[model samples]
Each structure stands twice: as structure tokens, then as C-alpha cells.
Target: MTTAIRRRGPDADGAWVDTDRGVALGHRRLSIIDLSPGGAQPMESADGRYVIVYNGEIYNFADLRADLEAAGQAPGWRGHSDTEVLLAALSAWGLDRTLAALNGMFAFALWDRAEGRLSLARDRMGEKPLYHGWVGQGEQRTLLFASDLAALHAHPAFRPEIDPASVSQLLRFGHVPDPASVYRGVGKLAPGTRLTLSADGGEDAFVYWDTLSEYARAAGEARFRGDAIEAVDELERLLGNAVLRQSVADVPLGSFLSGGIDSSAVTALLQHNASGPVKSFSIGFSESAYDESPHARAVAAHLGTDHQELIVTPEDALAVIPDLPGIYSEPFADSSQIPTYLVARMAREQVTVALSGDAGDELFAGYNRHVHAHRSWPRLARIPRPLRRLAGRAMTAVSPARWDAAIGPLVARKAVGVGEKMHKAAGVIASRDGDALYATLISVNPDFRELLRHPSEKDGFEGRALEIVAGLPLPDRMMAMDAIHYLPGDILTKVDRAAMAVSLETRVPMLDVDVIRFAWSLPADMKLRDGVSKWPLREMLYRHVPRQLIERPKQGFGVPIHDWLRGPLREWAEGLLFDSAASLDEYFDRPAIAALWQRHLSGAGNHQHRLWPILMFQAWRARS
Candidate 1:
């Protein structure tokens, strides 16, 4: 099982078994911190009460070690890996206290020999993954857990059955939300949670840290009494500290610079604090509309960092298609996974650790939906429901191309996405409330429930963990929803799988617990004001790079998937959707998919987003 996940840790492999207790633990080491046998796993405590196999890094391990020493609980450490510090902390402070004090990304399995208990935990932001479930029935049942599903598949007792509800969810959200995996009986441990199981089959799960609770606490406290300028300055300090802590790696480290506010801010702070130039990596595309390499280059040159870039062709992305199922180990349909994988592969050539600017958007209200909810929703709401629906129908009456042509002469070429945005906004305007509006904005298939063979038990928006913040302001509620759902489920999942596929460790500084709490405490106006989303974040970023260079519209870190599906990828897509129609009939309504494909080929409208998920699922089905 450990050998199956060697790509996640190629440096070393080890196994420890306790036949007397019917327990075994295995590990694959990437050797990021302490580069000696002292850092090896499955590591045991000096007292031999605890054994743990851990993945991911602890940026504040040094601080935690100092605290342990100050508290007079420090074990005379043999080596300086975070794992040793963690094990010591666990032995001293207990699981809950150790997890609460952590400021890093990690997923670990800790076994307590003294008590015959097993504990599993994931990082607060879902940066690392932990999958656990029982296999077999009644007396034959055996519990299985691993960082990757392939490892679980390696166990003879493991049997994976596809869950139709989760497949429908994949078609809806582009990724399966946590607490539910694509396979039945297996489940992802939610972030900020710890699950403990005893030898007699007693199990309990507790949330050690939760973003929803933090959001509520921040909102209730109403802290950050300072004005906007003070907020920005404090934010800068918090982010700077986060970057510095995450920069603690014995191996070469860098940042993924997209020239956007988020990555640019992280890159600038990294260079500002590093003794020398920090290695920054980005990828370019021949599709001018989709490429951000020039902007990243400008930022890199301005920052004077060691910059490297690759101009990727369509073939480069196409080459990665066949590898997606294995790379993700499930049916994930996020098209940007191509560029994310490419950039990670590029960085792996130069560095082992890379920091990203992922959760800033979710934490700081940087998504377009946040801005639209703030600016457009009130006006749209003022119109009666019937009128709003009429307006939405009217907007969709014209094709996206015609709408683009009508507005093309007035805006810059990069703003051509405006028409598609308008099309999406029209659909959202018909929503009855903020929840419905947010749901419409994020949905890839609004009517997926109807398209599936069996009725879906839950819609994308149902059973989410974000209901805690439902009574907050529309923008805050939406941001909270995104932080709990989209940030972890889609963004973090995409980066983790893509980067790990290349044996690279990617960290997100913006998601530091302190940073997240601070971001939520600020007044809503500080996050989005006067039609500018992420205003405070932009203010902080401006202190590093010129506003003009970074002030452009937000572009997704993406490939030209729409163009690819219609052009070079047409035959491949057709083979999956049409030639293999018989295979998909078990899940999809064939006539509906065929009609959508035909409409897309005719250029009547862009159905690529709708079609891509089907292709990904079909491709994954073929492999699974």
C-alpha cells in the first residue's frame, strides 16, 4: 500500500507491523525536513506509547518546539523534522491541544499502543487528504485508510463501488465535496477534524478546528476596530509572517506567480524576506486570451527574482489528459488541472517546495460572485421575481457570440469573457435569494439531477457545512460558503493532486489559520468596496508591485478548454460522447448529452463547461 503511493514520497519507504495487536503502519518519505533516519516513519515516541505516519509540513514546528521546551515537556530531540516535534507535542499536550496549536498543512495517522486506539486527522484547511473506511462485512470487516485511494486499492480486503450520488455531484460541482468520496463506504475526513477508533470498534469524530465557527466568532466579536489603512497594514504583516514561516524548508523552495493579486502578493513577500532571489515559476499559452505569462514575467522582473517559464502548446495539455484519472485517483473534471500539473512539473525541475496563493480569493472575497452579489444582487432583487426571470430569459435569448459581438467594440480584448459572465449573471438574477444565487453561480450543471439515470439524493448546495454562516451578510455568507466548500473541495484538491503527481509539495500561505480569522473579522467594506473585490488585499499588493501591472481583470489559471474541445480535441471528445455512448447510457441521458454536443459544435453557445465534466467522468469510468 505504501509502495503504491511512492510518487507522494519517493525518497524512502518503511513499514512497521504489530502482529500481536493486529495493527500495521507504513510510510513513504519525501525527506523535506530532517534528511536523516531520525526523521523516518513510522516514527515512534521515546516512551513507545505513540506511533505516527504523517504527510505535509508544519511551518511553525520551530515555534512549537520552543514552546515545548519552555513548558518543560521537550524531549531531547534527535533530529529537527516537524514529525519529531509533532510526536513530542502529541505525547505532551495530547491530540486536541496539539492540533489546535498547529499552523501548517498535514494529514496523519497516529496509533496509541497503551490504549489500543487509532487517531486520524487532516489539516484545518484540507490542504492534505486522509481517506478512511471499513471494507468487508460483519466479522470480516477491516478498516483501511491512506493518503491516496490507490493505496487503499492495494489492500486485498479493499473493494471500491462507485457511488452514483457522488458521480452526480462530480457532474454538478466538478469535484466531490468532502465526507463523500466517489466510492461508497470510503470517505474523506473533513478538514479541522480528528477521528478516533478503539480496538473494540468504538469510533468517535471531533472537530478540532472549524472555519465556520471561526467565521461566526469573528463576526460576533466584531474586532479590527482600525480603519481600512490599518487593516491593510495589519494584513500585510500577517501575510508576511505566514510567507516567512511557510518558507522554512531545508530543500529549495519557490512560489507560483500568476501575476494576479494573490500569487503576486505571496511572491513579493517571499522575495522581500528571502536572503537572495526566490525562484518563481509560471506557464504561458499560445492562446493570448488565456495566457498570463507576460504579466508574471513583468512582475518577476520587477521583483528581481529568479524566474523560469514554459510556453506550453496544446499538445502539452493533451498529453496530460490520459494521466488525469491516475493523477487525481478519482473523477475530477477541473480543466485547469492541466496548467496546474504543468507548472508543478516545471517547478519540480528546480525546487521541491512551492508556495501558492490559493485561499486568498475565498478568504478575502476576491471571486467575481462576491462582487456581483454585493453590487448587482440588490438591484436585481429590487425587480420583482417575475420581472427578474423575464430579464434573465431575455438575456439568454441572444447567443453568447452575438452578445460578445455587441459589446466587443466597447471593451478591451481581454474583457471578452464579459459576455459569458453576463450569460451566467442572467441565470443568477432569477435566483430567489443569496443561497440560490450563489448556487447558480457555481453550478456546472444546474439541471444535473434531471440528467442522471437515478434521482439524485442531494443537490450540490444541499448538505453543505456552510449553513452556520447563513445569517451573515450576503457577501460574508457567500465567502464563508466558498471557504468551506469551493476552496477545499476544488481549489485545494486540484493543487494537491497536481503538485503531488510530480512529487512537489505546494503550500498555501494565505490559508494560515490566523490569516483566515483576521480576514473574516474585518468589515465587509474592507474586503469589497466601490465595486472592487479584495480591496484590502489589493492595497497590500500595491505596496509591492505597481497597481497598473496587477489591476487587470481576474483571469482563471486555465487552459483554452473550450477551444480545445471544439478544435484539436473534437475527435477524442466525440469518441467518448458519441462512439462510446453505449458505455455512458448507464449513467447519463444520452439524448441530452448528444444535443448539448451538437449545440456546441454548431457554435450556438458555449457548452464546454457542461460537456467537459461528462468527458472526464467517461474517461475515469473507462479507467476504473
Candidate 2:
């Protein structure tokens, strides 16, 4: 895993093992601080009872160390890497209390020799990635884990089995939710939570902290602008300090400049603070809708940075599809992984460490889903349940306007119109009496039952869905939903696997705990206002760059998969869908899968949703 992540920092590599306890930890160092050998891992505590394998930079290690010193528990001195500081803190204060004091993006595994326990934790927003799985038993009882799925795949015990519910969720959204992996036995650690496994065969897992509600009530909009400006200023300070800290490596370091607000902000700040032009890289596409090369070029030129670009073709993306199972060690369906992987490769060609502008959207309510949900609640409340059914029926009866007729009419009616989807979405939350808000945020596959091969399959994930959703309070449910469901299951997982497959390390600055706390504390209006999403983030971006540069409609960073499967990828799609005439009963209903493909190919219904999963499943099953 460290070797795969070496592009993020090629300067050093080390592994720590406790063979006596049958455990091993590896570190792929991207030396951002304390470049000497003193910063190595698995860093040991003073008494040597605790050891850690950590990924990511901690921006506040200095202050943390000071606090420990003030308490008179001076740690054994070592190199300047945050690794040593984090280990010391874990040792002195213990896991639960120490985690409360951290302010960074991290995923770490700490082994306590004295207690004969293993603890795994991810930063609050899951800015970093961690994957784990159990193998055989009895002494060799294999339980392996890593920062990326590819490393776990290297182990002999790894077995790949498709999780049906994960497939359904992927089709509805773009990524799998936490605690569920594409491979049946492998799972991701939930963000803001910890898991401990012990030699006594006992296991414990629970949430350590969550800031959504606290941030929601922190301050009102009347004070938000001033607070926001201060927040941005502070963010600038944190980011600058983080980059400088991360830049302290023994190897070459670089940054990714997508020319989007986040990347541009990072690149600009890095250049402003650095003594020389920073090395940056970007990925472009031939397809116009997916192309951000022009904007990337503009940003690179403005920053006067050393930049390189790679314009990839559809074939370039398709070629990597086969490698998905190996890299993800699970069944992941996020299409943007293609671009993420390519960009990582481009940056790896020139430098080791690179910075990314991830998490801005989540922190600042940048997603249209959040705004749409906020706006649509009022309208949904006005419609009575009986009327909703009648209206749905009326809409369904209307003929297609020059399009295919059968399911199109049903789609036209049941579908929330682009303008009304958000409002109608409020129906999920408007009741104000239940967990409908969370249900609204996560109902993309409400009709999942329609696609299941058997009615019995619905029972599989129902308990999981209720348990996770029920555990969170109203104020935190949405963000918590994202943190647990979307962030690692999809976003972080997508970036980690894609980048690591190419030996790249992508760091998320906005996901820093401090920024997350600020995001949580801002008033709802600051997050969503005037029907505009991510209002505060918009305010922040306008400070350093012109709004005209990025004030256009949001275009998702995705491939033309829907079109391609209907076009160039049709043959491949069909072969997978129809070829398994003999042995299809164990996985999917072959007839149902074939019918969906036929419907899509015939344009009877846009069955892309139904087809994508089947195609991806077949491809993944073959490889696994």
C-alpha cells in the first residue's frame, strides 16, 4: 500500500510488525514534516506499549505537543513528523480522549501491546481512507487491512464476493455506503468512529464524535458574513500552514490544479507562500462537457506555476475498468475514479506529494442536493398524501412528447421535475415528525425492490439502514448520512483507490477537522441561501478570484457512461448481459438482466440505471 502511495511521497518507506501477536502495520511516507529518520513509523510510544501506522498530516501537532508538555508528560524526542506527536498523544491520554483533541484528516491503526488490543480510527469527515477484512482462523487467523484496497488484494486470503445491496446503492447513487464493501467480506471503517479487536476475541465499535449539530447552532447568519470572512482568513492560514508542513518532505512535492475553486485556491496559496513556482498537474478529457482543461490552464497561468496536463480518451478510461476489482478490493462503481487515477498518474510523473481541494462542497453545502432538499420541503408539505398519488397518476398518463412512450410517461410523472425535485424532496423531511429527512437524503433507490431478483433480498440491508439512520439526531442526520454513507463509501474510497493505483496521494484540505467544525457551526442560511447552494463557500471563493470564473452551472466530473454503454460499449455490455445463458442463477436473474439490456438497446426505457450495475457486476465478478 505504501509503495502504491509512494507517488504522494517517494522519499521513504517503512513497515512495523508484531509477529508475536500476528499483526503488521505499514507506512508509505509522504514526508511533509520532520524529514529526518526520526519521523518514521510505526512510531512507538515512550514505554513502547503503543505503536501506530498513520496516513495524513496533522496541522496542530505543535500545539498538541505543547499541551502534553504543559501537563508534564514530555514525550521521548524524535524527528519532526506528526507521526511521533500523534503516537505520543495516543500514549499519554489514551485513544478516546486524544482523538477529541485532533484537528486534521487521518486514518490510523494503533496496536497496544500491553492491552493486546488493536484500534482503528478515521478522521471525522473521512478525508483519509482505510479498508479491512478478516481471513482464516486459528493462530494464523488472518485479518489484514490497508490504506487502499489494492494492498489488501495482495494478500492470499482476500476473496471477492458481490454484495447485492451495495450494487443497488451504487446504481441509485454513485458510491457504496460505509461498513459495506463491493466484496462481501471487506468493509470500510466509518468516519468519526473507532473499532477495537483484541486477543481475547472481543470486539468493540462505536462513534467517537460528531460535530454536525454543534456547527449547525454555532452562529446565526447576521454574524455569519463577518464570521465567514474570519473563517476564510483562518482557513487560508490553516491551509498555508498545512501545505508548508506537508512540503517538508525529503522527496519532491507537487499540487493538483483542477482550476476549479478548491484546486485553484490551493495552487494560488501554495504559490503565494512558496519561494519558487509550485509543480502542478491536471487531467483533461476530449469530451467537451467533461473537459476542464481550459479552466485549469487559466488557473495555472494566473498562478505562474509549473503545470502539466494529460488529455485522456474514452479508450483510456475503458482500459482501466478491468483493473477496478484489484484496486478497490471491493465492487465500487464511481465513474470519476477514472479521472482521479489519470490525474494521480500525471502528478506522479513529476513529483511525490500533491495537494487536492476535496471536501469544500461537503463542508460548505456545495452540493445541489443539499440546497434542493432545503428548498423543496415547504412545497411538499402543502400536498396531501392522497393528492400526491392522484397527481402522480395524472402525470403518468400524459403521452411522451416525441420520445419513447411506455416507461417514459411513468418516468415523466413519478419523476420530480428538475425545478420541483428539491421541493418535492422536502416531503421526506416536511413531516417534521420522523426520520423522513434522512430518508429523503438517501432515497435514491426507493424503488430498489423493483430491480431486485427476488423479494427476499430486500431483507438483507433493511436492518443496517435503520440502525445507522436511527443512531443520528435530526440536525446531524444529513451530514452524518453523508459521512457514514457517501464520504468513505464513495468519495474518499473513490479517490484513495484511484490515486493509490497509480502511486499517488491526494490530500483534502477542507476536510480538516477545524474546517469541518466551522462548517458545522455556521447557520443554515450561510450554507444555503437565495436558492443558491454552498453560499458561504461562494463567499469565500469570491474573495480571491472573480465569481465569473466559476459561477456557471455545476457539471459533474463523470464519464459519458450512460451514452457509451448505449454506443461504443454496447457490444461489451451485451456480451456481459446475454452471454451467461448457462450459469446465471447464482448471482442475477439472467432473463431479467438480458431484458433490461434489450430495453436499453431498443430505447424502450433508459435502463442505464438497471444496466450499469449488471455490467459492472459481471465485470467485477469475472475479475474477482
Candidate 3:
């Protein structure tokens, strides 16, 4: 099983087992810190009661070590890896305090001989992954888990039953939400949680941290009393410190720069904190609409950093499509995964560790969808539900182009791409209430149930997010949901998988503990001021990078998925839906998929979001 994930850790491999105790631990080491053999795992503690096989860096290990020494809990020293520090901390502080003191990204499993139990834990913000399940039934039932699904699947006892409901969720949300993998009876561990299993077949689970509750607590403490400048100053200092902590690596380190507010700010801060020129990576395309390399290059030049870039062609992207199944090792539908993989591949050629600016959009109100939906919902809600539904039906009754030509100049302030915006609004205009409205706005296909043969019930993290963000203002509520749901499930998963596929490590400093708390305390106006998104991030970044370079409209870091589905990928897609229809026959309604594909092909509607997940699911099924 450990050999299956050799790519995640090319530096070393080890295993520890005690047949009498009925427990085993395996590790594949990436060897980022303490290159000596002393830092290797599966490690044994000084007291010999605890054993741990850990993945990911503990950024606060040095502080923890110091605290232990001060408290007279320190053991004789070993090499300086975070793994050793973690084991020692566990011995001194026990599971709960050691976990609570951690300030990093990780997922780990620890065995306790004294208690005759095993514990699994994940990091606070879900930066890393851990999947677990019972491999069998009766007295033979065995608990199994690993950092990647491929490792778990390689086990002889592994069961690979497809969960149809999760497939329906993939069609709706692009990625399956957490606590539910595509495989039945296997679950991705939730962020800020731990589960303990004992020799008697009893189970216990606990949440060590809670993102939504913590944010609410921080916000309720008090709004920031300072003005914009003070907020920006504090953000820059906190973000710079985060970069410094993550940069403590024995291997080469760099960052991904799209020249957006988030990436540019991280790059600038990293360069400031570095002793020499920081290494930066980016990827570009021929299609200018999706390219950000030119802007990234400009930022790198001004920051005086070593920059690397690749000009990706259509063939390069097409080559990655066939490998997505094996790479992700599960069904995932985010189209940006292609470009993300390309950039990570490029960066791995130069550096072993990379930093990313991912969570800024979730922490601040950076998404136009969230902002526009928040703005438009109130006015639409004032109208009666039936009238709103009627208005939505009338708006989408005609083709978007016909709508544009028919009512293009009627409004006082004509909306850009007025027809597209109107049609999007129509999807949520008739929602039953505010919560339902937000759910519809974020879904790829709000009519997802109609596509499934046995829709059954959702029973995933989707409902958890909606419940958490219940009565806050729409913009903040959406931001909280994105931070809680979309950030870990989609954005962070994309970064982690794409980077780890090639043995490179990526960190997101925007999700730092201090940064998150500060983000929550600032009023929404500070984030989305005067109709501009990420206002505080913009203010902080402008001081380092010229405002001219940083103030452009936000372009998504994604591929031209829609055009490709209709053009380059059409034949490949047909082979899955039409030729190999067995998976669809068993789980989904092939006729609905065929009608949607036909409608997209004929330009009747743009169903790219809907079709992409179906294609991804089919591709994963065919490969796995």
C-alpha cells in the first residue's frame, strides 16, 4: 500500500507493525526537513508508548520544542524534523493539546500501545487529506486509511463500491464535498477533526477546531476599530510572518504567481522575507483570455525574483486529460486542475516546495458570483415567488443572444454581458428562500437530481455548509461557505493533488490562523469596498507592487473547458457517453446527458459546467 503512493514521498519508505497489538503504520517520506535518517518515520517516542506516521510540515514545531524544554518535558534530542517534534509533543502533551498547539497543514495516524487504541487527525484548515474506512465485516473487520486513495485501493481488503449520490453531487458542485468520497463506506476526514478507534471495535470522533464557529467568535468579539490603512498594515505583517514560517525548508522553495492580488501579495512578501531572489512559477496559454503569465512576469521583474513560465499549447492540455484519473485517484471535476497540474509540473523542475495564494477569494469577498448574487437577491426577493419564477422563465425563454439584441439598451446602466447575467439570475430568481437561493447560485446544475437514476439523498457536506451559514448577510454568508466548503473541497484539493503528483509541496499562507481571524474581524465593507472585491488585499499588495499592475479585473486560473468540449474534446467525450455507456446505464440517465450534449453542440445553451463533471466521472470510471 505504501508503495502505491511512492510519488508522494520519493525520499524514503518504512513500516512498523506489532501483530499482537493488531496495529500497523507505514510512511513514504518526502524529506523536506532534516535530511538525515534520524528524521525518518514511522517514528517511536521516548516513552515508547506512542508511534506515529505523519505527512505534512508542522510550522510551529520549533516553538513547541521550546515550550516542551521550558516545561521540563523534553527528551534527549534527535535530528530536527517536524515528525520527531510531533512525537515528542504527543508524549509530553497528549493528543488533544499537541493537536491544538499545531499551526500547519497535515494529516497523521498515531498508535497508542498503552491505551490499545489508534487515532487519526487532520490539520485545522484541511490543507492535507486523510481517508479512512473499514475494510471488512465481522471479527475480520480492519480499519484502513492513507493520505491518497490509490494507497488504500492497493490493499488486498479494499472495497471499491461506487456511491451514486456522491456522483450526483459531483454533477452539482464540480467536486464531491468532504466526509463523502466517491467510494461507498470510505470517507475523507473533515478538517479540524480526529477519530479514535479501539481494540474492542468501538469508535469515537471529535472536532479539535471549527472554522465557522471560530470565525463567528472572532467577528463577534468586535469589529475592527481602525481604518483601512491599519488593517492593511496588520495584514502585511501577519502574511509576511506566515511566508517566513513556511519557507523553512532544507529544499529549494518558490511560489505560484498569477499576478493577481493574492499571488502577487504572497510573492512580494516571500521575496521580502527571503535572503535572496525568490523563485516564482506560472503557466500561460495562446488564448489571452485565460493567460496571466505576462502579468506574472511583470510582477516578478518588479520584485526582482527568479521567475519560470511555460506557454502551454492545446496538445499539452489534451495530454493531461488522459492522466487525470490516475493523478487525482478519485472522481474530481474542477476544470482548473489541468492548468494547475501544468504549473506544478513546471515548478517541480526548479523547486521542491511552492507557496500559493489560494484562500484569499474565500476569506475576502473576491468572487463576482457571490457579490452579484448578494446584491441582486434582495430586490428579487421583494417580488412574489410566482412572479419571480415567471420573470425567470420569461428571461430564459429566448436564446441569450436574442435577449441581448431585444433588450440590450433598455436598462439605464446596461449590464456587461447582460444576457448571460440575466440568465444566471433567472436560475436563482425563483429560489424558495435565501439559503436555497445561495445553493442554486453555487451549483453547476441546480437540477442535478433529474440526471441521476437513483438520486436517493445528498447526505454530504453540502447541507453542513448551508446550515453553518444560515442567517448572516448574503455576502459574508457566501464567503463563509466558500471558505468552509469550496476552499478545502475544491481549491485546496486541486493544489495538493496537482503538486504532490510530481513530489512537489505547495502551501497556502492565506489560510494562516492569524490571517483567518483577522479576515473575520474586519467588516465586509473592508473586503468588498465600493463594489470592488478583495479591497484590503488590494490595498496591501499595491504598496509592494505598482497599483497599475495589480488593479486589473480578476481572470480565473482555468482552461478554456467550454470551447474544448465542443471542439477538440468532442470525439473523446462521445466515446465515453455513447460508446461506453455502461456506467451511465447503471447510475445516471444517459438520455438526459445526451440531450444536454446535443444542446451544447448546437449552441442552444452552454452546458459546459454540467457536461464537464459527467465527462470527468466517465473518465475516472474508465480508468479506475
* Model 1 TM: 0.98
Model 1 score (lDDT)? 0.88
Tens digits of per-residue lDDT for model 2, 330-440: 556666777888888778778766878776666666665566456764466566767665664554344222233333355533231232243333344334433454554
Root mean square deviation (Cα) for candidate 3: 2.5
Which candidate order results from sorting by lDDT in descending order? 1, 3, 2
TM-score for every candidate vs. truth?
0.98, 0.83, 0.96
| Candidate 3 displacement at residue 126 in angstroms | 1.0
Candidate 1 displacement at residue 273 in angstroms: 0.9
Candidate 3 lDDT: 0.86
Residue range 1-624, candidate 1, lDDT tens digits: 998899999999988899888789999999898889999999999778999999999989999999999999999898999999999999999999999999999999999999999999999989999999999888778889999999998999987898889978988889899978999999999999999999898999999887777887796675578889999999999999999999988899999998899999999999999889999999999889889999999999999999999999899889999889889888888899999999999999999999999988898889888988888888888889999899989998888878877887788777644567678878898898888898888887776776678747787664445567866788888887787788888999999999998899999999887898899998677788888989899999999899999988788888777777889899988888777543878888888888878877877667777888888888887776
Off by over 4 Å in 3: 401-421, 459-471
Model 2 TM-score?
0.83
